[model samples]
Target chain A: MKEFKFLIAIWKTNLQSAMEYRGAFLTQTIGMMVNNFIYFAIWIIFFDRFKDVRGWGINDMYVTFGILASSFGLVSLLFGNAFMLSDIIAKGRLDYYLSLPRPVLLHTVASRTIASGMGDFTYGLISYVASGYFTWDGLARYILAMLLAATVFVSFLIFTQSLAFWLGMMSNFSNLVLNAMLTFGIYPITLFDGYAKLILFTIIPAALMGAIPAEFIRAFTWETLAQLLLGAIGFLALAIITFNIGLRRYESGSAIQTEV
Target chain B: MKHFAKYWSIFQITLLNSLAYPGEMVGRSLMIIPFMWIFYQLWKVTFSTAGADVISGLTLRDTLWYLMLAETIELSRPPLARTMSENVKDGSIAYILNKPYDFMLYQFSAAMGETIFRALVNAIFGGLTVWWLVGAPNHPEGFIIALPAIFGAWFLQFCLNAMIGLSAFVVEDVSAFTWIYQKLAFIFGGMLIPLNFYPQWLQTFAKMLPFSSAMYGPVYLSVAPSRELFISVMTLQLAWITALTILLIIIYRRGLTQLTVNGG
Candidate 1:
């Protein structure tokens, strides 16, 4: 419990430091917002041309994009620094977190918050509201889906970052992988057939992260809900295992002392 | 001649530096391939069902070949002529300028070397993968006709990117310009979808724009390569490259003069 408090303190301090750089923080926030808005524009063009793609209406596309944007936004807001996990590990900055009296993973994640992520969150919320897909009837399911989506996204970061143990320069690799997944992954999973769908659900988990959960809410299916729950659990387990194995390989040295 | 040799040496060093990071090179190349493949698959589905034998004068095969060629070409081309634009803004350009070679030529050569290396690797592996999976273009002449046109496209793109980078001289923030240029390329250059897929008016407008030469013209050359088409596409690319290159030289000279005058 004390460790948890310490972790939270660390997060607060980092956020405060970031707030000090108001100009950079604001620019980055606006940049992320504009970056996400462009894709929304592209989707508008897509739906404009084809009224419905594989039974996916404009409304459904908006929901998928919103859920994805929001889920990614949530991750970025709370654990945006997690994206830099590979870099931290590579540079032996993990030693600082390890020395702290907290779960290293928790400390690592809580160390930094992205002010820019607020832009993504704001854009996503606006998109969801604008899509008019949100109704009180499906509110519970949407919230649940958002929670599960966040879980899967966090699990993905953990899994990818754990790769830093073996791959020294894994940050760029992780970024490339994550970007590809987000760009190609958010579409209707059903558009993909056979082994492609299998890969999306299992290896990349893009389907489960964005598409499946949104699909579940749109057309509530016990089967899909179950799959999502199971997938989240499975991914969490995998990430934990990967992190533990990486921890075994981690060498605790005075690397952070020099930085200090 | 001495300057040329120094620039050549810098290019060689850059190439060797990239070669040292073989794992990164391979991983990035592998990562990009799947996304390209997905684009191919999506376009195939879109074209397969459309009853119109020709969508904007492009047949199904033409469309598919266009996609394949564009994916390969986009990967092969360097991201910018002035990747060091940000470096200039942050004053790291000072270290680069202190080197024996001209800073502009050194960076340009480095970008070219990296692009050449990526193209060779991507072509041999990525080309075969696409060919084996999607099958080669129906028209054999298409590949031959596209070769020179593709070169022109690369040159034009490089010049335009350099121009965008040159904006650093005037603009306090050039990153926004870079972002806008890349987004424009993705949208207007037909990287997202073929220009034919756009409305007829938009298609006409896109073709008239310089950005289309980077994307649409090469795709057109690859899918339906005729003597006349090749000449027209290459001529336009050459015109843009010459114009942009001259503009770049002028801006660079002016920027340098200002830098010296201000002691920046």
Candidate 2:
């Protein structure tokens, strides 16, 4: 309970700081929302000409984007520091987190928030509705999907950022993997087969971001639901284990300042 | 003619600086392969649905090639807007103003140098990817037109981004402006699907915009290498360049006046 309170207080302070630049915050939020919307528009244009891709239509795309945008937004807004974890590790900035009594990774993630994620969260809901899948059951499934997707997204970041310990400054590699996942998430998964499909489910697991969740929502299956739950839990465990292993390799280098 | 040597030296420094970051270059280049793979799959599905070899006068092969070219152009451009905005934020523009070289021209040369190096890397990587996947599309005798056309496109893209960067004088952050500009270029400029696939009205609207000249012109010319088409596209690109350069000059003057008044 005390740890939760600390996390909330830090988030509140970050939100206040972000609000200090209200105009910039709002512009960034809306700008990112529109930036994501353009991807959907591109798909829309493609569908307008070609109508469907491997039986997946524009509406499937809508929900896919919806889940992706919302889950990503939630992570960025609430746990923005995950995005910069590699940099923090590479720079030996984990000293501050180590000094704190709380779980370092959790506190580190909750330390910052991204304002633009608000736009993504909003865009997600709007896209869900626009896709005409806002029924009560749909909403429930969507929420569940978002939960699993968000978990996978966070775990993915942790796994990538943890490489800083082994690789000794691999922020570039982390960023590369993250971007590849983003590129894969926006595409229709039905088109991928063979090794590419295997890659989507494993190494990068881009499907968690959009495809599997969207599929479950489009047509509910207990099997897929089980797979998503397993994938999320499995990936989360892997990330935590990897991070802890990396932490064993971490060394504080050239500390310039001391904090009690 | 004398200042050309200055720009050349700056370009050389920028090129060498980029080469120094080999890991970053390789990572960035490798990242594009999946994007192209996705595009390949999407276009294949679309072609299968259309039941025709030529929608918008592009075969699956042509569309795939077009996507590679468009992505090459898109990725080659430097992050001019972000760098400029950072300079403005940190009051480094003042230091730049005191430098011997023209700030805008120096930055442009740096951007051009970085872009050309990245473009060459992407061409090799993307070319190999295409050759392995779908084989290279046949080009007409006038394939040489693409060189100048693509170079012109890069300049136009840089000018647009630089204008957005200069807007940092007024705006707290120009990321929003950059995002809008990039999306406009991607959507209307024929980055993913050619403008030919767009509806007639959108096609006309996109044609009139400078974004199309920067992206669509070069990609289209690569596939349909007609000399008449090349000349017209190049002319359009030149006109936009002239107009955007004048706009950039006005923005730079105003930004400088603001900076001086505010004691940047």
DockQ scores for all predicted structures: 0.34, 0.71
Per-model C-alpha lDDT, please? 0.73, 0.85
lDDT of 1 by residue, B26-88 (tens): 766665567656766655555554545676677655665676677667776665634556666
Interface RMSD for each of the candidates: 2.5, 1.4
Q: Write the per-residue lDDT of candidate 1 for residues A1-260, one digit (tens) a residue.
A: 78767867876777787788777677667776777776566666666665555666678777787778777877887777678888888888888877766788877876677776777777666776777777765667777887788788888888998899887768668977687768755675546888988888887888877788778777788998998899889888988899889988986556765221
True contacts kept of 2: 0.70
Q: Tell me, by DockQ, which candidate is best.
A: 2
Clash list (residue pairs), candidate 1: none
Q: Across residues A22-96, which tens digit of lDDT does each residue of candidate 2 receive?
A: 998999999988887886788888888778888888899899999999999988988899998888888988888
Write model 2 residue lDDT over B33-97, tens digit each, in one string. Answer: 77787888888888888898888788888888888889988988899999988888877777877
The CA lDDT at A111 in model 2 is 80
Error of 1 at B259 (Å): 7.2
Shares of reference contacts reproduced by the candidates, in order, are 0.11, 0.70
